[model samples]
Target: MATCLASGLGLRATAWSQTTDGQTQAESAKADPSQAEPSSGDTSSAVKSDTTTVTVTGKKKAPNDRDVYDVSKDLDAKTGTAADALNKIPGVNVDPSGNVTYHGRNVVVYLNGRPSLMLSGDNRGVALKSMPSAYISTIEVISNPGAQQSSGDGAPIININTQRNMPPGMFGSLSARYSSPAGSLETAFLGITKDKLSITLIGSYLNNEMDSRSLSQTSVLDSTDATLQASSSKGEGRSSYRGPFLMANLQYDLGPNDVLAAAFNYNRMPSDSTDISHAVSQAADGAVTNLFDQSGAGRFVTESAGLSGNYTHYGQKPDETLKMDGSLARSASQNDFRSANTYLISTIPGNTGTRIQTHDRRNDKTKANMHAEYNTPIGDDQLTLGAEVDLEDNTINSRVFGPADNDDNLMVNPLLTDDFRSHQVVSAFYATFQREVTPRWTVLLGLRGEVLHLATNDLTYRTKGNINYSRLNPSLFATYVISSQQKVRFNYTHRQQRPEASDLNPHIVYSSDTSVDAGNPGLKPQESDAIEARYEFNGKGLNYGLRGFWRGDSRTITTVSQIIPDPQGLGNIVTQSTRVNWRRRSAYGVSADVSRQISNKLMFSADATLTQSALRNPQISGVRSATSVDGGFSLNYFFKKGDRIFASYKRVGKSYTGQGYTTGSGQANIQYSRKLTDKFDLELMVDDLFRQTRTVTVIDTPLLQTRFVSSRQSPTFMIGLSRHFSRFGPMRAPAN
Candidate 1:
């Protein structure tokens, strides 16, 4: 294999009420909307509402600073998870492993405009894949965030808003879905709105399944371009997960201008997986030097729980508020893996003997966060001040055993065993101001200061280290109106990405028979400067927009591999991979998107981006650049009785890495939904219609060259049934 490395990695203000031309305060707010606000700021134009007071009217509208997608009407919401719905949105990509990216940059996800410990921790992938999407009202994407946002390194932000504002009484939904190859899901939602108290509950049971295969070839070449050793392998794997998830949200109106909210979530997942592989090694003469077959199986269980509370107080003055939030979460996992290697041919002594290996690993993580922000009106402008503290504690224990050199008894392998612990703390403070300089012009300026402390301990190696860093980030956002239908906006910010505890572990971990992965404690954090300009036209039933962006980064982190002598004293050499920091990197891109409502029943939307990225390092001969193109398009048809049909296709572009590059991949999906009755609905969905989702990695180094292709079995067909009921009366569409 290509030695794949694991890098699994705010509200400011409603603007002061203003009137321009013949527009009223409500109309002006609707037209421009407050652009970038802190996550902890509750005075934003799109702040969450209590379930008892929601109202939606007329056609939907989007703010100038961010892109909003309404998924309550999408077919996927009836049967799929939040991850599936996000992958279909233009300019957003979610890989099969549940990692999310925006325009090829890293992303951070929020729930109801606030950070969630479960969504930001290591189990984020699993949680996103399991959480039902039926309750989602809209998703907002912010490409260039403001300093008020506490996102590390200026990462893009995605906020998910659930349905809110009920008329009172009780309302809920129940859904069951089944897919081919033993995959199924059951979900339930309950909401109660009585007087000043609002309660929401969600529960789900999921059984996820997957089947995939991989083919690869690796070679070791000498200075004369002759292959010293080569190996080829083919592997197939199957895995499944069974899980139960539960969540509860409570909101109480302390008074007309004050509110208190608390949320709790818990989930448990038990999984089993198996893999089989066959390999043959050949020398320069093309003679088989060794042959072996390997089979492996694993059983794992993971559990996570979280609790959060928030309090908001609105001042008597308009656009004035104060908010405080606190959250705590814990997650733990236990895994047991066993593998056996049977040799059929050998040229060295004792090579024909069978070898058995066993691995036991446990991981635990705890997170705590606290945030407070105050917003107040300053003359015709708005000012926001905020402070936040975040703490994380992680522990990992691993033990591995293998056959003894002289006997069949298993012996502990110290090189593959470790007990690691890490603690991290972040404290930040920020200030932001928004001004209406002219009738048609508005600007927001902000600055934030942050301090980070990280400490790690390796019990097995008896090694310890401490890292400390501080940064001051600044941001700017400005908007100019050319006409009633056209507007231009600009943004600039500073961003950074700190190395994770796992990335600085400094311990070698086995990836496969011929490869190993390790971390470097000496790695530095990556920092970048980013800027963007966008022009948009909104008129009648058609909307179109164009954007250009550039980012320059220092200390770029990427994976690099090298040929190393086998630590096990095996005759064959192995590939050892680790993360490294490059001197600098730069990327620039342009994007365009258009949407047209052909009729009341038909709509079409499309988006595309062209990006070029370059990297520089003194160790390399010259700077290298790679061009990438990615795009997506979607079509939706609405029928009578709330029936709908949706179709979409998305492609992810190829980009350059430190030592290698990956190929592009795309897939098509279709879904159909019908109203079976006044209170019941039926839906069907098919993913990877063309089965074109596949990727290839090429690693070319002076001494080692490898090519690996991975493809997942596509074509999953799912059917689902859902029922919606309410006692207070039929609710209106979700808020925009």
Candidate 2:
């Protein structure tokens, strides 16, 4: 019987939050004392009488219980970062490798709700532009996640929910920004609460400078005996970046139903780059043969850290949770390649030749996790049980140097170095059950069981040892309440995705077309089978929703393009790379959203999404098919007593980067705010009003096909001012 229900769910997951009337029902549900009506720089407490509102995850009942987009009043009139306030939600998107998509899939970021260490690369855009979105307060977009959360393949999660009381005393904020074509400047500092324990600190300083120029033209066609070739290119570039960040958080409230929390973070990035290039080639009675010239310089660095903990009880009606976490990270990079080549050969002699290359890389990572949850009810139904444990460690080191004068650089190969390591362990058990089969129908069932173990050491190339995997995930949900404001839902899930540790470490990195990117240890592990359906409607001020989804996978991991044989043997020429796999994939989607209030003070909203994807590889032989779309719209207006005005529009289309396609983008934004008294406030913003330029195109399979273009150096006026203070001091001691 599933091993006695997974060994009684790990012996009740460490005694399910050790009770005491479930810590007084989780401190009266975290004292949500019906709050609302404190605007003018809010200070909480107000709501003359009850306005009844509660809809813990949809199904009727919610005439407003806080949150309709409010990131600390748009970070007191915005200034940037946190992906510029998550691009004002409404179908979210953040590409350029900072990856963050919604409506187009892939989204998973959380910070008070857990999971966040700047989600990889470019430090996730320098930790979302150096924090301070007024320390966020709500930004959830779970796009079909249920099964009590935590899975891979299904994507879309984006939690973020910070700022949880600390205002009975001290508060904080300080900001600054400037940009003139990437000659950037940004500053921030924030602090909070001071009695009964609570503290938050944030800091950021940045300097980015840039200049780039380019021009290109190309045409080539060769059919058996038919041939033609023509090409031209010119380029110039300069780059510089300096990033600094610090984050701290602490909380203690051990008394009113125990609580304690701690966190710390740091980031530093240093970068430099310079380049120049010229080229020309022609054939087919156009003569020119070939001519080329180039130059370069580069550098990089990164660091990260995190720690976490949580505990709760609050007696009886389902209330109990416990969690612990830890993390650490490090990075280093370098590249210097000086090049000069001229060829037109009139006799294998003199044409000028020079090349020098040096490359280096280092990385380290560590992680730990623990979990617990409990809520009981059996007869009238309603139950939840959980258990979890996870651990990870990774390391990579690389080095290379070439050029000792021709002969293919004296047959290169010496300095080539490599070292990669990995270790992972995961264990889980879960159960959930809910019922009320009528009274408007409701039913939920969930089950999870997992075990994974992996190990590798001194992996210098292919083949190493140790591996084990196991899984059993299941879920089902249904809900109906066709009146009093409509509602309907259905869901099914089975998800899994494991194989990260640099995709099974086997070291070799450094590419941006200087080729040399490797990793593959006979990779495997990927699973998914998901389904969803939803419909909702709420009146009064109107609100709407519609959703649909389907997913299937059995071994899926993409990014392929190969042509090896250059393990420094030099002569046999061949290089063009990228790898990772366990093919076979499928996807389907639909989405819609609407919100309105055309009267009173005006309001509006909109959202849309569509998707389709397929890939069934045979070592990939062109089985292409894909589609994706995005949308966003917004409007808001309110006059007097605090003021407000806003407008927005966003769109994205043209997908497929697994070697092809990209060219569709749009953006628009406008804002206004006021309140020049009772603690100050003033703001103004205008961005990308109509500026667009984002491109992508790739195809290196069966050899040769490339196109790449990039943009995002944001510029477009902004101004902000803010001030607030209330009973500043005393309240410490809320930790357990």
Candidate 3:
């Protein structure tokens, strides 16, 4: 089971006193005509500052080219992670598993306009939560992205921009929270910046503990046409997690057009859990029959670190720019489990067995990329051309051990120890042209070509294999202004999906009494063709949008059970079974959202999505087609100077969980915040306020099949206070 919660707040502060002073001096000189003449006389030797200013009253204005989505203005006061900030953008959403989707598709996330540590494996969630929202300047959502981007499963492109300027100063924030059933968390951040150099640091710690209880019942029948028995199971589980993170960034401006930036990030997470279950069966003769009891405890620890350096050259003809970025990251996790079970039979003495298992895994990844772009203009049109080359190498190692009851000694299999390595290289070239065809009509043309090569090497007991694959993807988009306040756009793209290292290895690490999972050695990539159309309308104080999209994929990958056992007597092993052009899927969906400021202190936003998808596979009989529909709505109100109120509700209809059968879930949240003083604030939050129980039901159709149903419910509450401090100067404008 996966729990969803945001981590502590970590902020990176930079000092910009010199830049601020420059701006202030520039404004003063502009006001005094006598001083402006000398400043303009020496054009070649004078400093030319890069800055802009705008005034805001009661209405919103269009964003500038350099301005991404503003965090303070775009997100609700209750948002926690950067993911929450990104989701507020049009055509952007984050799934329950923490995967970000754009325009109902997948997208990659970039930090500071470069590929960072967040793009890899399971670290995405941790990275998102550890980064504080206050440190972010803006988030950009790119739908039909260019070819210079990394190629992967289709996802919207998201770029997170950090604050670039603060007075030569230091600032930080502290916060604490608690949940009724989930747990408690505390986080803090601090940073310092000065002159032409700036350094920002962040640290956070979190502890989450959860307790749950459940009951289930099942009936089984034998192949001899005889009713075996009915069984009832009751179980309780407790789970807890403690995680800490530290990150630092340094930026030095060599000159007005040259800069060097370095960053380092580290995270450590430790978790422990225990589960106990007992089952009792009633015989056909109405007597107590077989009884079984099982219990297990497990501990897991993961640590990851990343380091990267970036050099940028910003001065060149046609406003050219070149960026070189390289990064290395490594992570490791260890898990241990201990279990004991007793089986009772009528004729023989009860059999008792105990097993202890441990698994240790490690992953190391390195990536390097270079990007160059040149911008030029022809007549009234603007053209930009860019190219990028990226290389990534990843390696993984795993070891597992199991021991018998009285032996108290663990045994390792020579064949089970395995090492897997994967290498990928992507080269892309792209160009974008924007032209003002007419006063009321503007056209933009963009094209990108990408070539990808992936190679995987597996060294394991059961199989030794190597596989390579290449792919080419293209995309196109267009937008037209029907009127001054209305616009329409259309986009189309073809994308590819490559299997991860863990999914491609042919190894069996762990198994249960009834179910076993094994990896596949010969898996192929999947391709998708997607298209979408959208329209937007901007009025006095309201912005509204509607979009429709359709996606079709080939060679879709799905896990299925194998009919035969492994020849090596690995017991009932389940391997990845490929359908080989036997499966086809198509989905279409539409979404609409509206944002408006009802008054000076009140704002409202709501969005809804509805989609229908179908799967056709002849090889798998009795498979039913399913559809999913989900949406959410939110309202926020401000009052009494610095107080805020928020309410939100989300619903997910019956959706397939891949194990055959459908599940439904929903959640609601309410929060309030008040400013106790200029530097202090307090907040109260409630999660799952409705206490809605999420349930999943499974039905087996084959002979001797059984039915099982399970449900889980949790509700929590939290209260917190936040404070700010500035060492060098008074706090500047609140971070937006």
Per-model CA lDDT versus the true structure: 0.74, 0.57, 0.56
User: What TM-score would candidate 2 get against the native?
Assistant: 0.30
**Candidate 3 overall lDDT versus native:** 0.56
> In terms of TM-score, how similar is model 3 to the real structure?
0.79
Best-fitting candidate, scored by lDDT = 1
TM-score winner = 1
Comparing candidate 2 with candidate 3, which one achieves the higher TM-score? 3
The digit string of per-residue lDDT tens for model 1 on 475-566 reads: 89888878866788899988677887878888877666678778899988888788999998766567788999998888888788877866
Give a tens-digit lDDT track for model 3, residues 1-736. Answer: 1110100011122211111112332232211111110111001111113332211111111111111455644323222556546544544655433456553444678876776655445666556655666566667666545444555645556888665444466777776666676765566766666656777776667676766665655444455546555556678888777788777778776664566778887887777989898766566565665566768777767677878777665432222345555666666556555565455432223233443445556666767766766654465555667777777787777665543443357566444456777787877777766665665445555666666776777766534456555556666655666764576777777776666656666765444433334566667777778788888775555767798988777777655543223222222122223223335577788888777768777767777777777666553464446676666666778788668887776665565422354455566778787878877777787767876544555533232233345444443687767677742242232111
The pairs that clash in candidate 3 are 16-166, 16-167, 17-168, 72-736, 106-154, 106-155, 106-156, 107-155, 107-156
- Model 2: CA > 4 A from native: 1-97, 100-127, 132-144, 147-158, 171-207, 210-227, 230-234, 238-316, 319-698, 701-704, 707-736
Alpha-carbon shift of residue 356 in model 3 (angstroms): 4.3
Candidate 2 structure quality by residue, lDDT tens digits, 273-333: 7777766656657776556565666666666666665655433222223333344434333
